[model samples]
Target: MKLSVSDSDLLGLVHLIRLYGKNLSKTWSYTITHLIRKIHDQEHFPVTDMVKKELNADSLNKYQRQKLNRRLENDSLMIEHMIAVQSIINVIMKFQYSKNDNDAIRELRSILEANTNCIIKFAIKEKDLKGI
Candidate 1:
């Protein structure tokens, strides 16, 4: 299948490969989440005004609003992004740890594709891509 990857996604993949090298584990949720959040903060995009409006509204409970605000302020989608990644990571890691090399590689490819899809959605929203 054809994969559509953005520049940011390519950079992230390259960074991940460099960080883990051949020693990469299929289960890299913890480290990857930390890295994603750090990178997002360093980039420092202001939270969308919509996010602030949502936070200001009373529709969300106090706890939920606070959590939402924190996430928005950081401009990091760690909570949702990590959730998307973990399941795929688990599937690939299981196959790898079981010595199923072919299946492991296939699953890894699927995981990467899924991640690219997520990043595309995020970039479209974050950059406010037209006609999206």
Candidate 2:
């Protein structure tokens, strides 16, 4: 399939990979942990009464487990993410090693085409891509 990846999206993936390497789950874990800490010690997560009341009903451990089940998103998707990251990194290496611009572009386009779905998922889900 012919996939059109915008330069900005490509840059975003590059940025994300630099921050988290091949592990996108670290970003998800950090975000959840940060919120949990705010809710527990700081009591600053849900300043409003309604949200706080809702959360008060559930134990923090249970809440964290639920979040992990949802965010981990199973091993298959995570493996795809890892593969996609490595493929993109390979393209970067190609550009670095090869003096021929055309050769590098061809290699990049090939990798992007082969891993279109995973690459797009990475580019689009910038919300979960964060620094630890």
Candidate 3:
């Protein structure tokens, strides 16, 4: 399947988080929150308030929020990611899927890995997954 540079970059950013970024405090803080929400929303499971704090955009600072919003706005890849991720979330939330389910995730991982160079960078400096 073909992907635009922006889409590839967004996927790479996600992959970077799954790899190096997964262990970082910030990554866990943010990703887990997003993950939980995705999982809950997709799986129809309930998440605690504490978990919500992690992914909540309102919890982010002005700069971080601005950066994230810009990244989402400017990147077509990110938009695609949102579409795909949300679909995954919807399936999971409906109880038709589970977190242990790997089909969609694996497929996405493969696609992103295949296009690593195009899939990971954002205009923001901190969003850059190069060193990590």
For each candidate in the order shown, give its overall lDDT on alpha carbons: 0.40, 0.36, 0.35
Superior by lDDT: candidate 2 or candidate 3: 2
Cα deviation at 98, candidate 1, in Å, is: 9.1
Question: Highest lDDT among the candidates is held by which one?
Answer: 1
Considering summed lDDT, which 10 consecutive residues are worst modelled in model 2?
42-51
- Runs in model 3 lying further than 4 Å from the true structure: 1-14, 45-104, 107-132
Q: Write the per-residue lDDT of candidate 1 for residues 1-132, one digit (tens) a residue.
A: 233334455355445544564576646556665544443333322233454454443223224434654766444322123234445444333443213444434444565545422221222335552221
Q: List, residue by residue over 6-79, the lDDT tens digit for candidate 3.
A: 43434444554454442456645456347533322221112223323433422232234345556464331111
User: When superposed on Cα atoms, how far off is each prediction in RMSD?
Assistant: 12.0, 15.7, 16.2
TM-score of each: 0.27, 0.27, 0.21
Descending-lDDT candidate ranking: 1, 2, 3
- Superposed model 2: Cα runs more than 4 Å off: 26-109, 117-132
Clashing pairs in 1: none
